[model samples]
Target: MKKKVQILSILFLGISQVAFSQIKEEKLILDRKREPEVKKIEKKKTSVTAEKNYPPKEKKTQDSLNLKYNITDVPAASDFKTSTIQGEDISPKFNADYQNNYFQLGMGNFGKILADGNISTTLENQIEVGADLHFLSTNGLKKEYNWDSSQSSANIGAYLNAFGEKGKFNINADFGLNDYNYYGIYALTPAADIDLQQKTNRFKVNGYYDFYSNNILNDVRLKSSILTDKFDAKEAQAELLVNLSKHGVEIPMDEVTMNADLGINLETINSEFSLLNDNTSNYFNATLSPKLTFFKGKSYLMVGSGFSFLNGKNNSNLLTEEAKNNKTYWFPKAEVQIAAADEFKFYGGVDGGLKLNSYANLLEENPYLVSDQELRPTETKYKFYFGIRGDVDQSIKYDVSAGFAKMNDILFFKANSLFNNDFSLNRSPYNFANTFSAAYDNGTVSEVKGSIQYFPLANLVLDGELSFAKYNLDNNENIYNKPLVVASLGGKYSLLGKKLNLGAKAIFSTDKTTNSFSFTEAGTTPNVYLETEDKNDKIGGFADLNLSAEYKVHKNFSIFALGNNLLNTNYQTFKGYKVLGAQFLGGVKISF
Candidate 1:
């Protein structure tokens, strides 16, 4: 029994030893597998250790091998430094600057003086105010006239503009003073001892309103003027004009634009002539015009009519019978335009109107006029015209037209040889046959005219016009002081980066005819006279050339020069008055 027990014990001892060895190997394998996982957890914990404050971790050890492991905490990183990027500042540049004010002064031969200035400013509330002054004077051409032929003119004006949301209003007032001397004489002799100095004063006020409210009411204008001359010739005029229009209305078909327009004009003129024993002439005119236009594909047709009512009273003995009539005028205003091609067009029209002739208007046409003159209204009975217009190219355009007109009471300027027929030096003033008087005649006129414009470059422009006319007068032998042929050519060019500008113009006019009357004392009476002969005096044609130049020293400063009548021809602008041979003016301009 003892021996059996010993064998079992030996077997148990061997089995126990084998089991312990197997367990030890398994523990080593488990530790190797957990090492990687433990390292990963330690790295994750170390990353967050700087952000959080944690208590110390417990140490771990293997029982049989007595192995230990430890983990260390990490330190926080230093604060990072931040900065911003910076760049250089830049400003805008421009080639030129705009100015709102200008001033100019000049002097030339013939004792000429000129001055012009303007100032404008914009205040708050869309309001603008401006003022301007202009003056020109000449001390006379002593060589041409034995007496003083000096002339002077001065003007001062102010304007105000108020802009609204949908409209604008403008008001302007101006005053003018003109001093002139009439030194015209007949070819045979000089006579009359009249007051040579004539002074004229003018004052005017103009008001305009333009609407942009997208309605039928378009614009309105009111103008008034007062004029007084040295001879006690006074005139007062007032005019009112109103325009109404509506566009984009379909009349006959779709996509066709129809426009309706109406215009009304009212004017009154009053005059008093001291030379005619305070003879007073008063006139009032009212005109109403209405038009309708239809536009379709670059072609348009307009049909309209005008009605005019005229009433006047004249107590002047010179205009007694003709001025005592009241008349009503009917005018036709019609036009048709057809586009034949992209570049060509055909047009026809008929128009007529009444032209008011006043003392002020006659003075403007011929300054050396007698104060006691006949005043009448010109009636354009009918004017019919047909024309062809086209564009030659993108840079050129042309227009040609032919027209025929019948007119009544057309005014003509004729020499008034009041006291010069006998060459009397001690006669009344303004009797040297140098002054002009109004002559009326019924006439028919036929004319052909053409115009062309060329714009080859942005800074260059050229234009030309030519016209020929034939006049047949009923009561006059020939058309007085009217040109049969007229032509003009003009051009402007800029060079040197737009710093230099040059311009030129040429004008040519055909000869004019003026009637010369001779009287012979036939009766035995002291003042009785009989007309002997009436002859036509011919005034030769003339050509005028003008040149101008301007050089910009700076953007705000410039020097200019003008050469007028460059041909130096001694030409007569009127029947007896001759213009200066050549004129030169140089000056500098400044702007701010």
Candidate 2:
């Protein structure tokens, strides 16, 4: 009897589970069917209505008037003049094919591997959705000395968009992971035994809503991200922005536009270091900007100002004391654009703002960074810039600009000290001197840059740009690892009936200098003092060239090859870091 009872209980549970699953599936289907009608894609056709008279007027035979006639002579066909008609010029159409889904995979030397794929589709009510995945990994390249330099990174993202008659909504989320080593020059090879590996994980979500109405609320945006690393370092940030605009306002000028924006940002950073213990920082800032734009026949002017308030607090043992600060700032927001001619325009502006720095951003700039950093925000006092942009013809376009700005709390990366005069290590982990520290200073910076794009043919494009900058610091002689000149040239061409494409790019940067220090013992035994001496090291200049070629094998398939660092200069971008030499990657791509 007990065995039978157990069998009956098992049967009953199985039946219940099946019924519940069916009910849940039905509910989901019903919910989908109940989507709002307003969200459905609507294409309205305009129609014109004709007015009709309620009653018809009676036909009346009125009085008839007298008539008069005149005769004209006709010309013979042989005497008439005839001329030839010119035909309109029509150019031949080129191949313009596109696909929404693709997958690519490639492998190269140095144990490199790359993979990428994207898929998208549109659903009912004009709802579009897509997902993207990417991955790249490489084993350590050949080095003079043995050091592990292997790295791998991957990311996946998804997006959803809904289009409506009144507004549009879009949301996307991404997750990424990176695993790499702090492969830099070290004084001793024994230090390599220490774990130099690091891993970072990040996730981000963004959303925006754009409205077509002429109301005050025109756009809304929200962004949030979280980042974490292997060494118990974490950072998270969230921001919200709303735009308000009123058009066709007649205030001091006809057809004026009034606009205002509100923004709020919040961030938190937590880092753990072996020597510095645990550090935590909290940041918050809010901003409001109001502006007015007046337009008059190809010329427009905008005048506005920005107000911001910041509040921050941090607790860290590395610093002498805990920090708590609150500050308010105001910045200018004004610009003017005047049309000098049909193909040329002159523009000028003065603007400035406060930008917050985060650990994630610093790491992206330089992967080898120490966690014990004094995080702060940089403030730009003001920047005045003027420039002209114009097109010489249908084939050439150019833009040139110059700007100067005074700034506070500008951050720079500097190498940490490696050892003492006796060649004794300073601290654990960072003793290798492979990691960089963040340093801040106040200074004024001026820059001039110009760029041009030329299209000599329908299927050929050429681009070039150059920039120069000068920095005058109040405390430091030079900004560490800042280049004075940067330039790039690139061109793309297509041939073989648009089936074959080729591209080439070249980049150059001037030498950058970084500060290094050496300590010497000045006193004896117990009273030993270490005097510090600063030395400037120059990172040599480098030029990198890259080339690529692709040929279509079919309507939906193509094969490609890429060559990077063709010069094989093996130049150091940083003081102690050396980049990889020449490499080649061949791959196939499929599109559907």
Candidate lDDT (C-alpha), each? 0.66, 0.63
Q: Which consecutive 10 residues in model 1 have the weakest lDDT in total? A: 82-91
Give one clash count per candidate, in the order shown.
1, 0
Candidate 1, position 283, lDDT: 86
TM-scores for all candidates: the values are 0.79, 0.78
Judge candidate 2 at residue 251 and give its lDDT. 60
Candidate 1 accuracy as lDDT: 0.66
lDDT (Cα, tens digit) per residue for candidate 1, span 334-373: 9988878535888899999998888888876677787776
Q: 1-592, model 2: which lDDT tens digit per residue?
A: 3353354345434533443443222321112222111111111101111113211121110000000000001111011011000000111111233344777788877677778777888799977788877787767544633657678888888888776766668888999898877676543453445566778899998888866553577678888889888777878878888877655444675644333333343334443343344677778878788777665555668788888788888777656887887999999988887878635778889999988888888887777786666678889989999887765554556778899999998888988765333444333545565678888999999999887765455455556778999988898888888899987666555666667866666667888988655445455654343635355778877676666677889978888777666666666766666766666778888888
Q: List residue ranges in candidate 2 displaced over 4 A.
A: 1-98, 191-194, 248-277, 419-429, 517-534
Stretches of candidate 1 off by over 4 Å are 1-100, 187-195, 252-254, 277-279, 318-323, 419-423, 427-429, 517-534
lDDT agreement of model 2 with the native: 0.63
* Residue pairs in clash, model 2: none
